[model samples]
Target: MPAPGSAALGVDEPRSASAIVGATVTGHHLLHIDGYSRTKHKLPTGQFIKSLPFSVGGRSWCISYYPNGLRSEYADFVSVFLHLDKSAGEPVKARTKFCLLDRAGKPVPSNTSTTEPYEYLPGGVGFGIAQFISTAFLEKSEYLLDDCFKITCDIIMSEELRTEDRIAASPFVAVPPSDLNRHLGDLLAAQDGADVTFQVAGETFRAHRFLLAARSPVFKAELWGTMKESAATMVSLRIDDMLPQVFKALLHFIYTDSLPEMEGQEEAVMAQRLLEAAVRYGMPRLKLICEDRLCRHLDVRTAATTLVLAEQHNCHGLKEACIEFLKSPRLLEAVVETDGFEHLTKSFPALVKELMCKLAAH
Candidate 1:
């Protein structure tokens, strides 16, 4: 009654390849320990207070807080752990993070610990940091307010399900990554919708006023505020003391939120100049990027110069990196012989004194 290649004969039916659906489930729990001092004095090492059971990734979980350490060897530290309250049919893969909360209940970055994904067997001592924080530090820090403190446990579990749902061997269409930056970069290249013009070192550059104002506070005031330049329909602003190339790069960043590729030696020069421009324009992220670039480029030849830039720009991380690089007596002696060190000593005598003091102590 049923023909071949027909539904009734089952030949026309599509075959489904098995597909495994997987996702990560994330959950966080906050445990507040009141009378922290009493707990530390009363609860001996290896004793813990258990949190109420919570659910994540379709499984029950809880946190174990040890005021004193979990073991006598770690008695000077506080410990935290994540425990799987429910038994699993197979080993579960998960990531765990523990964070000490500040007085405002926000997680302190310096006191957070994150773990890589680990396979957890049921009934085993769950994965966590044994020495989350030293007891001495806890007592001295502002985190322990009114003899109380809080901690947050974040858990991410990888869960998989085997299903019979049919899917194509390959997708019918592949979505591409975002091209917003590319489009904006093209817009900059095309000079379309540009309303502002800048004359820097006898060079002309065109840019959009709204984009510049949106990106930088200094640009906002210069273009949109009560400055005389803001009243013009097509404003022509003259920039003094900046190189045409640096100004061009700054416009590119305003449009694309990224820097163009440059040669190795040119990149360092560009980074230093861009850092100055970033500071002048109140672009904190770009300033940080330049500071990081300069830090990586530090050497005996460039250490003192980088330190001077860092000091003038108030880039603490870069300054510290430069100081660390110049700490060795051999390196210091070599750097002190450079002309950059002469400029640094003349410009930032206080910084030079600080470095000398640190070197003496070392």
Candidate 2:
């Protein structure tokens, strides 16, 4: 037999799609410093104490905590440094972030410090902030509970830039699709460190503020922007006019970038609600996915409602799909008899007129 996927077999030879991706590996370590008052007096200005070595991105690292600051000029401030503990032949490029934790073990967003990617040479080379926090503020803040506090360091290291071939034919190596979604889904289910809560339709849901802020601008604004919903240590929000299941589905998509499998006629109704939720939350991708589902599930019973939804939400593709489905006179007549038809015609007279014009043109 001829070689598989080869031209000799009267089949076009298979070719691999290749691209150069800048891959990165990330890891974090949290260091708890006990007896902060005792340690603060022991470390003189420009002196420091080191945390136990931790490994991140295959490199050994440690944090140098200077309780009295790194220099006399900054003596009134607490300083922190990230040092490379292991020697390497090539320069390692990495970005670093230091975050101070509250009593709840959540990073205080206002107190977090981040550094740009920097190349570290061999030996014990390090980089960090000299004015991490003011000593007076740390002594008075809630972060200093019983003379103890915690800090977390996150490291993102850049790996070698290389091309990867995604092959359909014979290949020596196989790379599986990313399981980030699975990990994120597990995080949502575990709710181990959820920092925000939502009460929707008498049901409660817990989630992380950072994750929510990262996913949606509306969420980001609500959680951390000028809108500033509330200042409670643990924020609890009451979401009105939304079903619990719809909010749950929206959270699922926010975390996993994919929706849970919904089945049958109820799925279409759920998609419609989810589309509205997506719009409310400023999640365009989710809105688009719901629109696509609505398009596929369009029927005489749902066509009128979906068309009204498409019109209200500015869903061009779904609007076209709805119009196409209503083109048949029998289907249009049946749609007109549906319950939503009255609401559609009354609430959106312009859309009704546009639909009539489209039909007349056709």
Candidate 3:
């Protein structure tokens, strides 16, 4: 058995500290083994040495070998190196490099004769490193020492295991209610003088108010009913019941027709507000956004309230989502124990009673 760091037959030691030695030929290629030696030895007739050279901790070494005389010429030559770093307080690194050599002991330059570096971390974990030299560089004899160094740095960083401390914390920090209200005031103030025009169902309407008053089904039925009777005609119906601040936001969306950028906890609130406005104004798209946000952001407590609101306004989708949320066994118990459930049950007695019975069966 070949010892670690020893070269196989017909392989030579690397010429430099950083260079990796690999196979001179690939697959089954017969070649004559003229001679082989490790520490400065001469080769026989057809035999030559191939090696990969690398240095770690201020020490350099190579791995080389000789081929069998009777081996078929189809056998290619390969050199393997085992690198060990013993620097104090430093990581241990190991890698392999390959090269192709001709019968006359010369490197056979080609796309296939490239070197790839692999790494072993401190804890015996292993991974592949990036390619040191590009194929173009090899073909043109353009040395990419600088590129290799850059790649080495990248590999070191890549191999460094990530701890929780290094990872970025969530940007969704909690915001004080005062700050939230202040931000809402600023949003509303920004749209104080804006006018927006939108079509609900089929009728077009214009409003200077920042809030989507048409979102209220009651208001939509009263005002837009005369324009078109078909449900499809309610295309541009605006929502009106959105909170004053939320209405301002909806108005902003109607005019700009773009999402409002927000950060942290504000994102959920803004999304919820926008969804409510969308649902109220008969904006199917915005309603969908709200549904997604409610599903993702609202906790069981808030979801129960949203359920009541949804049912009150005949928002079937929202109601269904709420029902699904409340169906969770753990959450159902929590909901039953809350004052909010009592209010919801009293408000939608039939629906809540039925839901409670269904939950009991589960």
What C-alpha lDDT values do all the predictions have?
Answer: 0.74, 0.74, 0.42
Could you give candidate 1's per-residue lDDT for residues 1-362 as a string of tens digits?
Answer: 00011011001111111122357677777777778887788778877776666666667666667778767766898877676654655456777888988665666654677875655555445557776887987886668889988888877776753233222222133222245778999999999877888999999998888888889999998887533545546778999989999999998888877776664568789999999999999999789878866765778888999998888889998898898888888998999999999998888899999999887887
Q: Rank the candidates by TM-score, best first.
A: 1, 2, 3
Q: What RMSD, rounded to one decimal, does every model reach?
A: 20.2, 22.3, 26.2
Best by TM-score: 1
Q: Looking at model 1, which ten-residue stretch has the lowest summed lDDT?
A: 1-10
**Candidate 2 RMSD to the correct structure:** 22.3
* lDDT tens readout by residue for model 3, 276-306: 5665557775666555445545565676777
Instruction: Please tell me which predicted candidate would have the highest lDDT against the true structure.
Output: 2
Q: Model 1 clash pairs?
A: none
- Per-model tally of clashing residue pairs: 0, 0, 59
Decreasing lDDT order of the candidates? 2, 1, 3
lDDT (Cα, tens digit) per residue for candidate 2, span 166-249: 112222322222458889999999997887899998999999888999999888988894225544457888899998988998
**For candidate 2, what is the TM-score?**
0.53
Better of 1 and 3 by lDDT: 1
Candidates 1 and 2, the one with greater TM-score: 1
